[model samples]
Target: MVVESGGNARAGRPRAASAAQILEVAAQIADDDGLEAVSFRAIADRLGTSPMSVHRTTGGIDALRRELVAALVGDAIKAIDWPTGWREMCRTFAYALRDLLMRHPLVLEAHRQSALEAPGADDIAHRVVRALRDAGLCAEEAAYAYATLHDFVTGHVSIRLGRGDFESTTAPAERRGASVFVDHHDYDRRFETGISLLMSGIGATLAPRIRS
Candidate 1:
């Protein structure tokens, strides 16, 4: 079933309600019972308001989900302490994004593609690209590097958390001997190793150009 939008609900302004409060309650519902459980009625029930009020504030579920994703990405970006070197900065960002996804996997559910266009997304992208440019990568190369790094980190986290079609827990049960390949325990180390290898490869490829 699609998300409940509360279009037919009775109209009434909720007393002293705010968009932030609505989002907070909606996120809480999602975190507790998955994204499908979040609806205008659910949020209103939690906030002691009406479904129409919630819907009016959020403009329906899709917009609310987009806002939720944007808020989360913005906050996560603000919390990062960027390091000196480009590689280190990229590594830190990868870790930070991974951690944020792990903590609030439902935010991605709120809006899977929204994070790319989310408020703080451009800021983080600029920082990464600037770092790469400073490290001697041309604009195109820096953009590619940032995009690749972002996809790797986000994709890894999605699979790790079983957020996408790839359910880590159920994958082994679906096929014979798949459990051997589905090593859930070692993802932490694997993620680190993956980042290290990626950084190494980028540095090696750029060393010749940087030296010139």
Candidate 2:
């Protein structure tokens, strides 16, 4: 490892590691000590290279963070056993996403910033929307459902991450008084409940209208 004024400068020429190696080490640091700790300097020290090499390989630290988050979420999504049925598929996806974000809370910010990178593009959006349409919702309704489910899952993670810190932003309820809302911070139950409500509402919206 290099042990310099900035980091630990060692005696040998820094070991030549690829971008993949840099990413793997950076992920380790992030997993162990949060994303804030996974700096270029930190990754360089771990890889026994200069921060400039890490930077050139990754384009920049921000790009590295985006790539790492994208890789992780994309892989995790691929690993899920996506159910054949729409409702079940939705539930499976919701749980999988929540589990992943809970493990790596920092990735959510990167996810939002990068459009969840490529995973949020065709892969996820297509399946969910098509499933919603198959479940009897029209294109417009399917679009809304997609937006709602994505917002719900991301909102759940954000709430847990920024709960007490965001108390002042909660809206006041007449019966409940000025309460910091989070459905009692029970996301496990709330996620399932939201899915059920979404499916049920979608079904209702598809009901035939009565003649005047």
Candidate 3:
């Protein structure tokens, strides 16, 4: 999806770089050093241009960040071609999105902040909803199912990322302490089981409604 920005050029000179170029540089910076590391000058320096030129093309830093998030999410959505079968489709999408968001932690933050209110997000939502409808769900039922499934995936990934306290350290003493105090959960297995239950629940509910 093309990024929505203010203008294509600066005051007098024609801007040499595209929004995509600027956004990619910004996304790279954010992905490497966290989102706070990204700034207009940072992107400009990487692009070998002035900060004003970046601003002219991107509108401002906020818009630039928004576009960066959109590009990342859009790429994630495009990575998984629509799989066949309802169960396969839903599970594949959930896992794919989880993997992508996990790769770019800042994108998760941006998604939480803006909900991806762009064409990229819309496309992703539409594909999942369409899968539900294809599996005998009516419009309203599909909407609800999509909401439940999407929320589950988003929440799971968010929790996994936000659970930094429980991640990365496997020391014996710490493991013992965590086992005693934190009661660690196998999130991957938990997510798969939950996905099965969710899809089954939707099928049970939607099948009856479709029959009646």
Name the best candidate (by TM-score). Answer: 1
Give the per-residue lDDT of model 3 (tens digit) for 1-212: 43333343334464456777887778778978888788977776666667888898989888778777777777777677777877788888788877887788887777776677555677767777888888888889888888888789888888887775356354466666756435546787778888999988987977776788
Q: Write the per-residue lDDT of candidate 1 for residues 16-66, one digit (tens) a residue.
A: 458878877777777777777888878877666788877888888878876
Per-prediction CA RMSD (Å): 5.8, 5.7, 6.3
Q: Which stretches of candidate 2 lie over 4 Å from their true place?
A: 1-9, 30-37, 164-185, 207-212
- How high is each candidate's TM-score? 0.77, 0.74, 0.73
Error of 2 at 171 (Å): 19
Ordered by lDDT, highest first, the candidates read 1, 3, 2
Q: What lDDT does each candidate get?
A: 0.77, 0.73, 0.76
Name every residue pair that clashes in candidate 1.
none
Answer with 1 or 2, whichever has the higher TM-score: 1
Q: What TM-score does prediction 1 earn?
A: 0.77
Say which prediction, candidate 1 or candidate 3, comes out ahead on TM-score. Answer: 1
Quote the positional error of residue 52 for candidate 2 in Å: 2.6
lDDT (Cα, tens digit) per residue for candidate 2, span 63-170:
888788877877787788877877777777777877888777767766666566656546777788898888777788787888888788889878876663344346
